[model samples]
Target: MIRLLACGALATVQDRGRLGALRWGVGTAGAMDTLALAGGNLLVGNPDDAAGIEIQVPPFEIRFEVATTFAVTGADCALMLDGVPILPWTGARARAGAVLRLARRASPQAWGARSYLCVSGGIDVPVVLGSRATQLRGAIGGHQGRSLQAGDELPLGSPDLSPPVAGTGLVPPVVALPLAVDGLPALRVLPAAEYECYRPVSRAAFWGEPWRVTPQSDRYGFRLSGPTLTPLEPLELRSHGIVPGTIQVPHGGQPIVQMCDAQPSGGYPKIGTVIEADLWRLAQAPIGARIRFIETDWDGALAARDALDGWLSAARRALSYLRARSTA
Candidate 1:
């Protein structure tokens, strides 16, 4: 019971994500902002990885082909349901012909990052390697492995209607600690597989200098500019499995953050892996924006991930509590 009344600049389905197919040459493509997507789904009582619409630029208008409940998260797009203002990072309901209008977000244009719209039961699409996430590089997944366009009807299949599950909201915003990003825009680095091959001076400076994100960035990879990092030797290796957080430095001596839709295998040397909890912040960084990385210990990283998991669990419990109260 999902239908598209109108299509905007860029909008498609995503979830907590796709994974475990790197050996088969598939990249995990899902919501760039996992925190936001997770919150939206919990609000509607949907699974964390439920496929949801990712709305990019504004002027997005959708007409519900059927009655359904939904939620929006991430970028604060002035959202509306049948012209009634609704919360972007909150949940709501819709009926057949219900027009959901999304205006430009209130945030600075720099934060034109991806936002999510999760419908209950998720968006029905062919599952590719235990996921419906689209990976255009491998020529598979998603709605034909590309962004959604006009006249293209996305299959929502049939959704079971359920009463709204009231719940506690997601985590409150926090003031990021100083030096939380390592240095003032300095990308952190750890020893890489070929770290020794790089000149000692380059290694010393790599983690100390700041990098600028270039305009030549997309879902496949990010191009960055910084202090030249010429290796002591022309090092090359056999193609190996690549992870989304891997920073690939091509011959140009610039770092590229392999994004969600990056290739599964690569020959480029990786300086380090972006910490799991910080990868989503990459999505909000814009062209010419300075970037810095901070190395975190295993215990610290695990604690951060576990804390988020705890919050998600609390959201579900809130729903159960609300449901019981409503029944009573």
Candidate 2:
């Protein structure tokens, strides 16, 4: 078990996310940066989708009730365990009552917006709708279905006594697999159903310009400030099913990129959908940061997904070998 000593808003228990409940209109509320979560889990010897704490606002502090192994990943923050510095993405063992502190990012230029804290056993939140992720909008899962607060004591699953070799870590996915456009982080976007409705100039601008992530961005969606994407004519579409990564261009001309906690359906015009493989890059994009889009086709999107899968597979194999060598 671990107790929250200090926690900022939006920090909550999350797994891969609530899946297959969209028909009931439940949004998938999971870690904003899933690659970070998975990397932390791998360091702690947990399943790829194991539940962990997603820290959006930092200065988070927690105390281990029992001796356990853990890892912190994602944001390049100042991590301290009982006053001793711990490296991000590295696994470490904590004695009982040791306090873990995560300060704000060390650098603004760092590629991180969220961080993941994964333990050997994962957080033992009740499974709701086949997931442990907190559905904040529905108030259904996670700890009381809300953000964790000070003094919250979260239960943990049975610990994996033989954790990964201590101090071992994987290279962060951001560094391992990089994607950028003109020095700005980029996401592969496939043109959506309403792509043709936009004027030729609008399409060119969407592809050529870098969009700034506005302050209004949150778990729901990223409201982007960029070239006004005007359609050749006004468009009105019936509310239709949408998923995370759907980039909707509203009447205001600013594009809104749906995120993990976005509604199941939307009525806005979608100019493009960011491929699932690159959503993590957008998730880590800081507010006020500018990012560009790379136009892609169905085949390119599939290839990107395959590349991500290959990276995860290689990480798993490497970790397994390390564990075996340690025990030998």
TM-score of each: 0.86, 0.98
Q: Which candidate's TM-score is highest?
A: 2
Tell me the whole-model lDDT of each prediction, alpha carbons only: 0.69, 0.91
Task: List candidate 2 stretches off by more than 4 Å.
Answer: none
- Candidate 2 TM-score over all chains jointly: 0.98
Encode model 2's per-residue lDDT on 5-107: one tens digit a residue.
9999899999999889988888888888888888888888897668999999978999999999999998788899999988999999999999999998557
**Which residue pairs overlap in candidate 2's backbone?**
none
Candidate 1 deviates by what RMSD?
3.1
lDDT of 2: 0.91
Scored against the true structure, residue 237 in model 2 reaches a CA lDDT of 95
Model 1 Cα lDDT, one tens digit per residue, 232-258: 888778988877778877888887888
